[model samples]
Target: MKISIFAGVLLISAALIFLGPDTADATSFDTRHVNMGMKADQCTAVMNEGIRRLNQANTFCKSTNTFLTGDNAYHTGTICRSGERGKVWPQNHNLRISLDIYPLVECNLKNKGAKYPDCDYTGVAYTNRTIIVSCTSDKGGGVPFHIEGNLVKYK
Candidate 1:
């Protein structure tokens, strides 16, 4: 009886370990793509386009949809790992990583708004100085994917 109970507990633990929630999802990979070897300005332009689309869909900006929590006005960095979490990708000459600073805004609806979806423009607005992206080889060129966030440094 003791051996059977131990085996059952071990099996349950292994199942939980393999079935835990994953941090990255399909939507996370659905980010804007940037070509490898592109200049900083070009990469920023692509990211800006994604932000513009998100802003347009935001109801606080007078759109018909509401912004979900944790949504930023600009493209912020995402947790990037080569394989499972914490495993780093082997360095290669073709891999390109770029870091740049960009503007980030947070919008909220005013509590005293006369009507719904009234723009408040009272959320945090600051510069994201640590936008890190990685570009890997694709069909014709490298496509940027992984976005890593870093601690904000004030200067």
Candidate 2:
């Protein structure tokens, strides 16, 4: 009986150590809710649309005579990644990765119009960039759940 209990405990411990924690919570970091094997053009369109929405949020705040903090801005745009959005890629992480999102968009809010308050109006320009993301397989295939980093230059 003692040996059986000890063996069960050891097995559980090993499983925890090797598998890490349950990744259900990680789904919150899925800013784009993208899946693995997505084509580059599709990813770019998604990213650009996200940026457009973010910019629209900023514009709305300005029009309403309100100023949103960085966090609020992200939230308003439905792009909130609670904790794992901008972390550097971990070498030992267990999640599958997809680098298919190449030449992505890097958006910035630029203030425009002299008499339209500080940031009431904004504009965006599309540019080619690279992004690194981590994915998790929950439904069936892998879905991207984190934006590991945005690469400026890559080989």
Candidate 3:
């Protein structure tokens, strides 16, 4: 009886170890994408703003992998593909700002589907400094480029 009880306990422990929640995994939750009706000129402004905020605050925030907490960040990049188009627009020097924000908004491989929502027309979120904006190509179906960042006063 004693040996059987010990074996049962060991089995249960092993099961929990293997099947319990794995916090180490990088995963994004509650992903949603919204259309912003933005243009290339606006996207440039957002990129510049994000970099400025980061530099001024000397800190950063990112879209957390947690579900529905509403803390948000933006990822910026240029999407150029042939055959199938998403959004098309002229490229300029400001587009390079995406590289600056890359570190702040990288998604975790485990949290693979993480995405931020579009900013309101006023471009304010939680505070005036944090904004979510997308630049859609004047051409139809060109994937929209995004820039999101925030400046907040911690109370």
lDDT score, candidate 2: 0.37
How many times do residue backbones clash in model 3? 11
User: Predictions ranked by lDDT, top down?
Assistant: 2, 1, 3
TM-score computed on alpha carbons, candidate 3? 0.21
| lDDT per residue as tens, model 2, 38-78 | 33334334433554765643332221111111212222111
Better of 2 and 3 by TM-score: 2
Measured against the true structure, the TM-scores of the candidates, in listed sequence, are: 0.24, 0.29, 0.21
Superposed model 1: Cα runs more than 4 Å off: 1-79, 82-100, 112-115, 131-151
Error of 1 at 143 (Å): 12
Pairs of residues clashing in candidate 1: none
Q: How many angstroms is residue 70 displaced in model 2 relative to the true structure, after the best TM-score fit?
A: 27
The lDDT leader among the candidates is: 2
Each prediction's Cα lDDT score? 0.36, 0.37, 0.30
**TM-score-based ranking, best first?**
2, 1, 3
Question: 1-155, model 1: which lDDT tens digit per residue?
Answer: 99999999999998877644322322343343222333322322333344466664333232111111223323322223333112222464333232334443333333433232333333434454333334333222333344433235355
Give the lDDT of residue 120 in candidate 2. 26
**Candidate 3: tens digits of C-alpha lDDT, residues 54-146:** 463333323321111122322322322222321222363222121121112212222223222222111222222222223333332223244
